[model samples]
Structure formats: C-alpha cells, structure tokens
Target: MNQPLTLEELKQVMAEADLLKTEADVEAALDKLAQEITARISESLPVVYGIMNGGLVMAGRLLTKLNFPLEQGYMHATRYRGETTGSTDLQWQAPPSVPMAGRTVLILDDIFDEGNTLAEVVKACHAQGAKEVLTAVLVNKVHDRKNTELKIDFIGMDVEDRYVFGCGMDYRGFWRNAAGIYAVKGL
Candidate 1:
C-alpha cells in the first residue's frame, strides 16, 4: 500500500490544480443529464445503480433531479482501490444491492476513463438478467485508451486527458469533496 499524503501536501495538490469545471457547471450538467435520462426511461421504472465511491456525489445530486420514481442502489466494484492507475483485476467489494432481473438498469459513475470498470459492471448487470443496461457519467475523459467498446448513454461533459479530481473523483483518494472538477498539475 502507498503511504498517505500529508495534510500540507494535500492542500498543495489542490492549490496547484487547474479548475476545469466549476460547481455551477457540474450542476448544469446534472440538470441536462436528468432531462435526457428522464426522456428515455422515466416511465420504465429503471433500477438505478450508482457505482460506489466515485459515483457517490454524482448519483446523489442527479437522483434528486431525476423527478421520477425508481429504485436506487449501489455496487462497489473497483479497479483503482484508491490508486491513480487501475489494476488489471476488478475487485467486487460489494455486489448489486438490488435485483435487476427482467428490469431496466441504469448505471451511474463519475467518469468514463478507460471504460473497463463500467464495462464490467454492465456485463454483471446483464448476467443478472437485466433487460437493458444504460450508462451515464459525470465526465468523459478524452483519450484513446478505452479498453471496452461500451458507449456512455449520457455524459455531463468532456474533459482533457489528465489526472482529475473533484465532484467525487479523488486525487490519491483525497479531494473527492471539491465542488469543482480540477486537473492535477503536472500529472
């Protein structure tokens, strides 16, 4: 395991980070996502699963704006486990909290980076008998390192390929609480 970053270092990390999207920007994006999602499945009574940790903030805020009745649950599958880079294997700390058999499933996450984690989650949902699975992300990192062909159904915004934190994304597992999206300096 890596040692924890010091408090001063954590502060410095944020201090030198570049603000990519403000809180207002994120909020507006959520509004747009909520509308798009509602237009597609508001009446389907979809089972919404927030991929834990990174999805926490985005799911919470987006859920409230959805304006539709749906079952909300969480799954804790991770490839990062707090590190910047992902491991080859996905660790399922927790499985789906609700059954998706014969139901429409919507997966919410913070970012669509390389697409491995989300792709695996979608497959799991299918194996559990979901009639259809859709994906939504707060940010889509622009790059060509995607490991899966899965496409995000809804995206709040596109960001440059950089190590990012905030709006539930973390830097060394810190700064997930930052209101705005930020890119780590020199990363």
Candidate 2:
C-alpha cells in the first residue's frame, strides 16, 4: 500500500497539477449539456439523480441552466472511497430516495472511466421501473477499458486517460471544490 499524503503534500501536488479544463470550459460544457437535455426530455418530468459527492458539482451547475421542471435527488455509490484507484466491488451507501417507478430518470455523474458504477446504477434504475434512463457526465475518459456497452447520453468533455480531480472529483478526498478539472502530474 502507498503512504497517504499529508495535507501539505496534497496541496503541493494540486498546485503543480496540470489544468485540463478551465472554469470557462466547464461552464460552456454545462450549457451544452443543458441544451441537449432540454431538447431530449424537457417535456418529461424526469427524476434527476446526482451520483453523490462527485456528481454534486456537475448536477448543481447543470440544474441552473435547465429551464424545465424536474425533481432532484442523490445516490451515494462509489468504487473509490478515498483512494486514488477503484476497487472491484461497488458500495452503495445510499440509493435514490425519489420515486422512480414508470418515470424518466436522468443520472448525472462526474466522470465515466471504467463504466462500472454507472452501468450498475443504470441497471438499478431500470429495476426500479424507470421507463427511460439517461446518463450525463462532466468528463468522459478516453480509454479502452470499459466494462459495459452503455453509452453516455450527454457529455461535457472528453479527457485523456489520466487520473483527474476537481469540479467535484477528489484527490485523496480533497480538491473537489477547485475551479476547474486538473490531472495529477506523473500519476
């Protein structure tokens, strides 16, 4: 196992990290996502679930741009608790509290890396009798290691296959409130 970084060390790492997406870029992406979501399901009363912690930022930002009426909730499921890498098993601390039966659901998350967590969440939504399920992510990692055939309905940006943090993604449980997305150097 790797030694955990001290708070100072984490700050140093973040200071030297490369900025992948600027705040302006993130705003533009949210605007686009909002537009696409509106065009696709604005008339439908969809339950929007933010995959908690990481998805909070994206969901909140996107919610401001959406003009239609919608219900919002959160789901807390994670493969990485506070570690740099994910584990094989996903832990569901909390599921969506809203009623999803026979309703359209929109699940929003931070990044689509391996497609594991999102795939399972989508399945759970369907199991709950969601008539239609749509997914959106702030960043889509350009990788070849996807474990499912699921396609994200909306995307903010396509990032290189690197460990990223900020904009609600954490590095060792920090930096989620950073202005933009950043990739750790030499990770």
Q: How many residue pairs clash in each candidate?
A: 0, 0
Tell me the tens digit of each residue's lDDT in model 2 across 140-179: 9898998767889999899998889998898877899987
* Each model's Cα RMSD: 1.6, 1.9
TM-scores for all candidates?
0.94, 0.92
- Candidate 2 all-Cα RMSD: 1.9
Q: What 10-residue stretch in candidate 2 is worst by lDDT? A: 81-90
Q: Which residue pairs clash in candidate 2?
A: none
Residue 105 local lDDT, model 1: 98
Question: What stretches of model 1 exceed 4 Å from their correct place?
Answer: 80-89
What 10-residue stretch in candidate 1 is worst by lDDT? 80-89
Give residue 14's lDDT in candidate 2 (0 to 100): 86
Instruction: Provide the global lDDT of candidate 1 against the true structure.
Output: 0.93
lDDT of candidate model 2 versus the reference:
0.90
